[model samples]
Target: MSSVRLLIGTRKGAFILTSDGTRKHWDVSGPQFAGWELYHLKGSPADPNRLYASQTSSWFGQVIQRSDDGGKTWNPPGTKPEDLMGPDGMPKGESNMFLYDTSAETGKPLTTHQHYDGTQRPWEFKRVWHLEPSMTDPDTVYAGVEDAALFRSTDGGKTWRELAGLRSAKGHLWQPGAGGMCLHTVMLDPGNSQRIFVAISAAGVFRTDDGGRTWRPVNRGLKSQYELPDPDADVGHCVHRIAMHPSRPNVLFMQKHWDVMRSDDGGESWHEVSGNLPTDFGFPIAVHAHQPETVYVVPIKSDSEHFPPDGKLRVYRSKTGGHEWEALTKGLPQRDCYVNVLRDAMAVDSLDPCGLYFGTTGGQVYASADGGDSWAPIVRDLPAVLSVEVQTLP
Candidate 1:
């Protein structure tokens, strides 16, 4: 029988939830790195026992850590967050260099970039927003950080180097969204290792055919009417989150600031498929494990109101990919529920019937073992869940 593991990152710390194939009773472990912000946690697809984490602090800065024994223990190749600085104020170690820049400055941006209205703003490394382990390399992982930059760590989070070439994709014009300019989504093409896609707030989506060496903006069809002088501009859309089916790498689904979009040509272009959704403004999106045509999204009221529409918590499912959607509300709260789901908070596991899971800001982690036909909470209280990822074990 297969087993399952749920790696949950929360605002206060991290937790590991385990269950067998049946996924009925679960075993919960830890508030690891307690009192710290566990922005993201992900396991290597090539070696499930190997895991990586991004831990951030308001006073200590950011540090990357790794675990070799399936969450039993963790100690990445980097220095401790509290130890990033030395007693004499000199640079201490490798993790201090921060993302692509690699400068000695540990916390803030040194240079400035063009903002949305063509204003200059310093890039901020607030935290690592997402961690994507290479599907085939256990030691190779990708980290997407705030203020929008991509970094790769091939030595199991021991060291990181920024993919400086990403700047060629008109990065100067990229601006921060309400949550800061974060390269929050990094989707690897299952069929093409050399091709990579990344999404940035206020900068739209960019794709690279030659790994991370070169990138080009693929936002030709993305339209952002708000916060831009030209809604038709090619590089200022605030893409909330993007999802790609493992079998169909070229096909993409997006939960934009206000519209649900689909890209049939590998993000070369896009078209809105909001269809019958109550409100298109929301975060987080996922593709079903076996059905590429099926997708999921949680509909929030609007960008201004970051809660479910009509005070109801509902997960919308689309069997036809985009234009068509139905609310999955069997075990969900339908009244006065206003919890918001973040971009990295929803995921699907590749089980026989497949399974769907998501975490909400109200400290609730819900699961659906038989797809989205029904729902149940694995845990009702945790520190405002930040991100959720699932792994299926043999």
Candidate 2:
């Protein structure tokens, strides 16, 4: 029988949950790095045992950690991931290994981007918000970082080079949202290796057709009346999260800061599908594993308050893509529940019936063995859940 592994990254540390196909009982492991901020953990589709993690701290900065035997072990790739700045000359002379710097690559200072207050600020490196392992190569991976920049490590996580071309696509226009202008979503197209899509908070989504060499803003038909002077600006839309099925890469679903959207022609354009939803204000959005038309989202009260609407924790499902939605509350809290779900905190597994999983700000991780029809909690208490990734093991 096939089993699944859940890689849970939280505000404090990381945990791994393993379960057989039934997904009823689970074997939970670790607060892995103890006190580190594990922003994201992703397993390589090409190699199930190979995993990558983003470990960060305000005082120590960001470090890329890797594990070859799944989550059993971890190590920073090129250098000692400590905050020691000395002439000892670290592996890459980077006292903080992952700081956003273009001196080595471009011999220029970091590009400045538009700030929320209409001021320009130099891009800064804070943390890796997401890690995307290549669909075909276990040794290749991509990292999306704060102050918004993209990097790729072909030699596993040992050495990384910035794919600075991403900046050419309206980098100066990109502004930080409430989430700090981080590139939080990295989607790799399985059909065309050259095509990759990424979403940045408040900066909208960008696509690269010729790999990482160049990119273009694909935010047409997306309106942000209160956020931008032009309701349909090419950039500067606060896109919370975007999801799509591997089988249908062109079809896309998005959870915006205030609306749920859909795109049938990739990211070339998008349209609002927030119909029938109590409130389209939410963070995470996901698609069913087997049914491309089935979509899920958790609607919050509003941006000011991140909790669910009416204090009822419900996962809304749209069987006909968008516009039409149904609330799934079989075993959920229907009242006095104020938990919010983050963009990277939801995921789905490739199983017979399709298992859906999501983590909450209240430290609750819920799971549904049969799509979004019903749900149960895998674990109730933990650090604030940051991300949840599922891998189907053979």
Each prediction's Cα RMSD? Answer: 3.7, 2.9
Error of 2 at 24 (Å): 0.2
Could you give candidate 2's per-residue lDDT for residues 1-394 as a string of tens digits?
Answer: 9999999999999999999999999989989987989899999999999999998888777777888898898877655455334456544533124545466454144478998778888887788999999999998999988878888888778766777778767888889888798999999999999999999987999999988777889999898898789989999999999999999999999999998999999999899999999999999999999999999999999999999988899999999999999999998989999998999999999998999999998888999999988999999998999999999998
Question: How accurate locally is residue 129 in candidate 1, as Cα lDDT from 0 to 100?
Answer: 88
Please write out the lDDT profile of model 1 over residues 1-394, one tens digit for every residue: 9999999999999999999998888999889999999989999999999999899999998878789889899885656676457678754676534655634442223356676566887766677889999999998999998878888988777678887667657777887888888899999999999999999986889899999877889987777777577987888889999999989998999999989999999998899989999999999999999999999999999888999988889999999999999999988889999899999999899997889999999989999998898999999999999999999999
Give me the displacement of residue 63 in model 2, in angstroms: 1.7
Error of 1 at 67 (Å): 0.4
Predicted structure 1: lDDT: 0.87
Poorest lDDT segment (10 consecutive residues) of candidate 1:
102-111
